[model samples]
Target: MAVSFLSTVPNLLPIVPVNASITSAPRYPTLGATVRCSKIEADADNEERFKRRSILTCFGATVGLELVRSSGTFVEMAEAADLIQRRQRSEFQSSIKDTLYKAIKENPDVIPSLLTLALNDIMTYDKASKTGGPNGSIRLSSEISRPENKGLVGALNLVEEAKKEIDSNSKGGPISYSDLIQYAAQSAIKQTFLASAIRKCGGNVEKGNLLYTAYGSNGQWGLFERNFGRADTQEPDPEGRVPQWDKASVQEMKDKFSAVGFGPRQLAVMSAFLGPDQTATETLLATDPEVLPWVQKYQRSRETVSETDYEVDLITTLTKLSGLGQQINYEAYTYPVKKVDFSKLKL
Candidate 1:
């Protein structure tokens, strides 16, 4: 979206009354003129300061993007993105509660697969180096939850779950971390599209499109596809590409994205597309309180949470927030079925 400014007056002084006889005329400033001048000065200062703030915010967004790309945190981004999708879909499906819970329980593996796909896409094409080489090892779990790693924990949770499932099903076979990473990466990219749609409908910023794109791209997972035949460079690039959240501006956001080959219109469109699902839980919570507590407890146990947790927590938090349906009715919303236009997407 285009950044808007409050109205301001011109700073140039008004032309003096022209008189051939008098070289100088009595200069009298009108009351409106003085007020306008003051307003103009204040507006100028505010715009300047806001510009700086925008740069800082953009920087913060960029850093989030880098963390996901470099740290193999695609799974976390997917989780966050899925939460948004679930919330959106819940708005249309009548059996959303059961569906969400069952899906959460059944496909713990989905997130990891998605995460891996996203990571592979980014690292494969971008100039940045892959973090964990065959010899260079790092703990994916710990890195996924770092403060600098905002917007990625959700998908990572899926990866953790996938590992557990693999261990359980293998009957003692070694689980493949590499495979999980590839899957999670893929899921993250799909989630970006889903999250963008929710945000367009006015969902919360915490689960918004901007964060999804920021985290996904900053980490280099959401980059454009290039010729696959290019040779792989073993060396890693410098780290300045990632933008910081608190110190970024709109211009900075535009600049950084442009540097990666995205334009202002594309950035704006993406920003308007995704967001978190805020009301999904509230509806569930309002419907059933007796079963809500257990759900909330289960959700809190994980370092990273998901829509399933939110669904469970909704029931739990609702019970705690308000009494059972004696006076309130908490029915889950239906899920949406309309597909978004993918052809219009820039990223």
Candidate 2:
């Protein structure tokens, strides 16, 4: 039966035709038919893709190596730049300090005026709108001529002269009037501290200065001085902001101080800036029930040798007042100057 079945098959045959159609559908079930390419064409296409991928890989490796090499130098360069900036700032501040120190020595009368300039300028700050502050706007002719800012022109002139000299000596750009005004106030406060010590030392200026330095809070001025680089406003601030010291009532004074975010204690601590005498200021402010206690406390503290409470509060309050509505310029003293090499020049 097996031999008969084999004979009936006639002959053994290949499963596939010799000349199969290239466009024929797949024998098994498929989603779609496909176009078949010749072996040579497929090989060429793959070679082209490999060439592009190799080129891209080489380019990427070269860039990555460069970045890795440069990363080591970037930090060092940044540190060096920062050092230069700090050094320049220090030198700039020292120059100004020296010039002002000599100028102040020549004219000690300007001390009171200095504090007045800062006080009136800072008093223009309105907490609600955040419009004004110690921005040297008090230097304007219109502003200075106002009743609230009377007698400030002399102080303005003193700083203006210093500005001229400072500008001439500056390696960086000129110092703004805003920075000068606030810095002068800080210097004035230091002078006052020194003056007090000097008076205690039998009117010997040098001895007084030495004694004051030994009091251990001589550096309190740093609280105000460290926040440097203030900007000036071109136009004058609106009127009715500052207190009219000549005629302002106690309630009016309290109200004005309240507008600028100060309490009775702050008002009492800052009495010296309002007028020449703290005792007289306390007497006038003592009429108010709310402000009387602070006035009395500072008055008592003023009698002590150190006057620690008064000085500490004054410095802290003045620092806050000076910073009101100010946007500090971090690059104020970091200008890079080019030096001329005379030896290399032909002329």
Candidate 3:
């Protein structure tokens, strides 16, 4: 029998709340001391460990920072950071960078491609959740604006603003807000993915050229697609649509996506596929030793731990327990799927 794509797993994974209340908190300086060593040995073994730890911290901080900064906004600093990191890591050939730059500059639609990807993923997830369907009178803007959304909200806002500009410039031509928001959201996703990739490669957001193609560059990821001409609606969706980050269970997450018309397969794929990015704060604290203590304290106050530390610790623990990187490998895999063409569908 073919695999059922819509069926939920019997034993769902528990949602570990990052921001739960803690009974006792460690002092900031003490927490910082836990991760920091006083002296650096120039020995081979120590050097190797130092390099690994540095790389891990860099990646973790970048992801955490991007998450915090981008939460609920569209202006993408993460994209800029991704490009810089990519360039530093030499992930793309110099020739490829040159080409991408040319394409972005010549084609205004290039940025929109990234936006579309981000939007579609969220929309797809939303659609998959039985509890968060489009027909339930939920507001798109409100849902996008939730605090849990973090960096995504800003990206959505950018989409809304861009749609207005397009409509106004069109001199009464049809442009939908939905289409624009979708595009922006997808772009944010692309940015996040690229940023995440950079962190994985031991780079940070300071580098700009690696994050985005310089305007008018060629050889980008794909061809530019035209907008479907959707307009924005000012109305915010009623409450109870977006899932609380702290309260979300695997089942609840699935239900939220189902409500938005997405399926179990898509949800599973997304869970595995989406690359993580850091918040701005995470990046700053990780790279600078002076700020590490403060960051730890702040996180503790919020009943959260450093996201970067968590990612590394979780991966390390799982690898040790399993004696294989299977869990890590699975989490790293993403679905190579194309964006949904809303223009072709009768919405």
Candidate 4:
């Protein structure tokens, strides 16, 4: 395991891979045109937006991680993740931006709170699934009031207030809290991304130039381009009934993360991935000391001058997770990934 990681990770640094195939592939530009990267390239000024949505490609993967644990089939997980992400409230993104920006400015001292808010809503408890003889009608706070949700108090408060504001000002009714949860994570990622880009580009990227970001394992790993038609009218998720985390072991973590389709390799990568960036993993490390080494590896790999391991696992995991998103897409669409022949093409 160590060798696989040590060897594979070093070569994968800088995350973003060049999709040279797309560029080199045969294609027409326009009338009497051959090909140029500009023909298919998106404008650089819009890079931030692309990064936001592309980061969102992880939405399905993250939500799906929980479903697979409860005996979920790939298609079932795909359906559920697709449904949840489709309904995400864009309003929550604003709050997320604020929270993550604060984290960037303040650093680890404030990271615990931000990470707590970002991760609390995503514990995989569903509202609609809370059915029994004695249970009352599921109100908005049903799951939010649960013991499992203790970590999410701040996130819940934020959403509750945001919902009320939206209801008061917007033409439409308030957005669903479930959707808002997904958006919170989305916003955090976007803010972190923009901040990182700014710092790397000398605090000011030119009007048209590359935004420094690793594309991860496979190029387009985090890019989800398909549309999801699942409606927002569906019921919220039922509460997730998971075991307590106290005294949990590394093997236990492996078993649990495996349910979400992650293997030791992924855990290895994710440890190095989530550990350094989010700093929220500190909450987990406090309870699960076994992951300390992996987290340390992530730190060294990311910050060390060697450049051998810098951000390798992060990019690798993102790319792999993007592939997982595509896998879910494949199942949800119930169609094969369409193969394109560049040789024969019109417009």
Residue lDDT tens for model 1, 1-347: 12322223322222211221112222453433321211112244344444445434434444554454445457876676567654543332213223333444455444433332222222212223322221101124443333323454564455566556544543223234433343233334345334544454467756555544443332332121111111222343223433432244556545654544445433332221112221332223324343245334433432232333322332222122111111211121213346799999999
* Tens-digit lDDT track of model 4 for 160-198: 555565446533334444344433334444444444555
Name the candidate that leads on TM-score: 2
TM-scores for all candidates? 0.26, 0.74, 0.31, 0.40
Please provide, for model 2 over 17-109, each residue's C-alpha lDDT reduced to its tens digit, 9 standing for 90 to 100: 223221222334232223121111113424443343443443455445446656758988888877887778778778877777777778888
For model 1, the local distance difference test gives 0.34
CA lDDT of each prediction against the hidden true structure: 0.34, 0.73, 0.35, 0.38
Estimate the lDDT of model 4: 0.38
- Candidate that beats the other on TM-score, 3 or 4, i.e. the better one: 4
Q: Model 3, 319: alpha-carbon shift in Å?
A: 34
- Which ten-residue region of model 2 has the weakest summed lDDT? 1-10
Compared with the true structure, what per-residue lDDT tens digits does model 3 show for residues 253-331?
5565466545443333233122232243244333434435544543443232123333233233211211111111111
Pairs clashing in candidate 2? none
TM-score of model 1 vs. true structure: 0.26
Candidate 1 lowest-lDDT run of ten: 222-231
RMSD of each: 25.4, 16.9, 29.1, 24.0
lDDT against true structure, model 3: 0.35
